[model samples]
Target: MIYAYIAVMAITTYLVRALPLTIFRGKITNKYIRSFLKYVPCACLSAMIFPSILFATNHIISGAVGLLVAILFALRNKSLVIVAASSCVAVYVTELLMTLI
Candidate 1:
């Protein structure tokens, strides 16, 4: 039963990916549709990242510091590696200080 469900899910996922490229041979021309599609990944990523980020550390201040650092890096148009590393550093430093205080 689990194998059957997995097979069905695999086929559905495959079709979702394959059908779009196969059907949309021409470049998408609608500006609004293109704009919406462009932001989808960002929206999806934020939805996935935000709640986990907030609750990740035992100390709320640590998470907030990390989140603030990440936002600053993003606003400055830093690369992903920079944003991620800086956020981790911010969280670690904040948590370390929190433990001592």
Candidate 2:
């Protein structure tokens, strides 16, 4: 019974995802649609990042500090690596300070 349920779920998932590509193979010529699709990655990335960053450390203060540092680096148009490292460093330092205090 469990095997049957797993098989059914796998088939349904595959069909749901594969059917879209099979149906929409042609170029999407609509400018608005194309523009929307182009920004999807950024939207998706933000959706994935925000929640985890909000609660990444033992204290909320560390998380907030990390987020602020990350935003500052991003606003300055720093490289992705630099932004990430700065955020990590901020979080670590904040957490360490919280521990000492």
Candidate 3:
């Protein structure tokens, strides 16, 4: 049953990732659509990250720490790799301290 669940999730995830590229190939020439597509990944990432930052326990302190780290990385013009790594470290350290306390 667990294997079946994993298989189903894997298939669904693959389809979601592939469907857009497969269906939209050669169909996204519009300038506005192209502009919107450029922002989609950032918007999606923000939506995923923001909730944890905003509403997690110790909201203000944790969120501020994460936000500050993110902004610092951004200001440094760091690559996404660096930004993501730094943010993960910040969140992990914060959570660890929370657990310890």
TM per model?
0.63, 0.71, 0.64
Writing each residue's lDDT as its tens digit, candidate 2 over 1-98 gives 99999999999999999998999999999999999999999999999878787787888888989999999999999999999999999999988988
Alpha carbon lDDT of each predicted model: 0.92, 0.93, 0.83
Clash count, predicted structure 1: 0
> Against the correct fold, how does model 2 do in TM-score?
0.71
Candidate 2 global Cα RMSD: 3.1
Give the distance in Å from residue 40's predicted Cα in candidate 2 to where it truly belongs.
Answer: 1.3
Candidate 2 lDDT score relative to the true structure: 0.93
Off by over 4 Å in 2: 1-23
**Model 1: CA > 4 A from native:** 1-12
**Model 1 agreement with the true structure over 19-96: per-residue lDDT tens digits:** 988998887889999999899999999898887877998777788899999999999999999999999999999988
Model 3: per-residue Cα lDDT over 8-74, one tens digit each: 9999999999998888778678899899989999999899777666666465676768777988998
For the record, the alpha-carbon RMSD of candidate 3 to the native fold, in angstroms, is 3.5
Ordering by TM-score: 2, 3, 1
Winner on TM-score between 1 and 3 is 3
